[model samples]
Target: MKKLLAECLGTFTLVFAGTGAIVINAATHGSITHVGIALVFGLVVLAMIHTFGDVSGAHLNPAVTLAFAAARRLPWREAPGYVVAQVAGAFAASLLLHFLFPQDTTLGATLPLGSDAQSFVLELVLSAILMLTILSVSTGAKEKGITAAITIGGVIALEALFAGPISGASMNPARSLAPAFISGHLSHLWLYLTAPILGALLAVPLCLCVRDSTCCCASPTSGKS
Candidate 1:
């Protein structure tokens, strides 16, 4: 129960702070700027990982949680609860944003600025890189400690800096889903739903290549997963 609550709270904070930057920026005519928004996302993730990481492994993103399970870091039985908590927290944040920004349509939802395929491919790569950094720096399923914080945050910042204009640099399903559902921008939702998970799963095999066999497999103390 504590783990579930940690996930929920971590996800809520992430969605709220990150997307809230977009909403405020749009409302204020980009005062936050693209760079500022990217930094907000990176910093928020860092803070959350440090805050709730030990409790829930800070799997605020469903793709991360699912990928951990796929890589055998997290148990399959617990994946559903993690995903549910993440989605629920996202919904809560989006609803609140909708209430606050009734005039805006996207509610900071991730929309493809280019063709669906283009955005789909971009999101896939972004998620892959992000998850790869995560798995490499993390211990087991836990994204605790300084190295995990800096690397994960740095990746998010870099991805958002380069890809936000083209693909929204989502790399996060729950983050993309809440605003889309709340704001009724579901036309390209399938890409977000599929790409991040696929990319994250793809990182599992890649991890095995760059890391020792023990690092990517399942074992309590063998650094597998």
Candidate 2:
């Protein structure tokens, strides 16, 4: 229960602050700029990880939760609850944004600036890199502490900086889903939903190859011989 609440609150804050930057930038005629928006996403994620890291691992991203489960760091049973909390939180944030900015369209929903195929490949690679970084920095299923927060936050910021103009640097299904659903920008939504998951899953094999087998793969026995 506490974990779910933490996930919800953390995700809500993520969407509210991150997408709010986009909405405000558009409303104010680019006062925030692309760089500023990227920084906001990164900083907010850093803050959330610090705030809720101890409680719920501060997933705030369904791709991340699923990746952790695939990596055997997190139990599969908890993935659904985390995903639900994240999506609910994201929707809550988007709904609030809609209320505040009634005339605003898209509400910072991620859209492909290029062809769907281009954005799809970009999202996949970006998510894989992000997931690999998370796996390296995280402890078991939990992404808490200063190291995890800074490294993970840095990776997100970096990716968004480079990829925001292309694929909106979504990297998270819940983050993309809420605004798209609310703002009626559903076209090309399938790529955002599928690519990131596939990318994160792809990272599992890569991690297993580079990391210790015990760290990346689940073991059935307690003893090591």
Candidate 3:
């Protein structure tokens, strides 16, 4: 229960602060800028990992949770709960944003700025890189402590910086889902949902190849740190 609550709260904070930057930037005519928005997402992720990481492993992204389970670091049984908590929190944030910015069209939903194929490939590669970093830094399923927070946050920021223009850098299904659902921008939603999962799953085998067998195939650990 505590873990679920932590995931919910952590995900809520992430979506609220990150997407709020986009909404506010649009409302204010780009005061925040693309770089600023990317930084906001990175910084908020750093803060959340520090805040609730010990409680829920800060699996605020469903892709990360599923990847950990696939890597045998987290039990499969726990993945669904974490995903649900993340999605619920994301929806809560998007719903609030919708209410606050009633005239806003997308509410920070991720959309493909180019061809769907282009964004899809970018999202897949970006998610793979992000998951690789997480798998490298994490302990079992948990992404806690200073190292995990900084490295994971930095990777997210970097990816968003480069790929935000094309793919919106949505490496998380829950993060992409909420705003798309609320704002009714579902045309390219399938790419965002499927690519990240496939990418994260791809990282598992890559981790096994590069890392020691024990590192990627360790016995499942408790969800908490």
Q: Best candidate, lDDT-wise?
A: 3
Candidate 1 wrong stretches, greater than 4 Å = 220-225
Clashes of 1: 0
How far off is model 2, as Cα RMSD?
3.2
Ranking by lDDT: 3, 2, 1
How would you encode candidate 2's per-residue C-alpha lDDT over 1-225 as one tens digit per residue? 888999999999999999999999999999999999999999999999999887888989999999988888887878899999999999999999999998899999999999999999999999999999898888777764688898988999999999999999999999999999999999989999999999999999999889888777763221110
Give the per-residue lDDT of model 1 (tens digit) for 43-145. 9999998898778888899999899988888877788999999999999998998888899889889999999999999999999999999998887898647
Estimate TM-scores for all models: 0.96, 0.96, 0.98
Top-TM-score structure, candidate number: 3
- List model 3 lDDT by residue over 61-125, tens digit each: 99999999999988889889989999999999999999999999999999998899999999999
Clashing pairs in 3: none
In order, the Cα lDDT scores of the candidates are 0.90, 0.91, 0.92
Whose TM-score is higher: candidate 1's or candidate 3's? 3
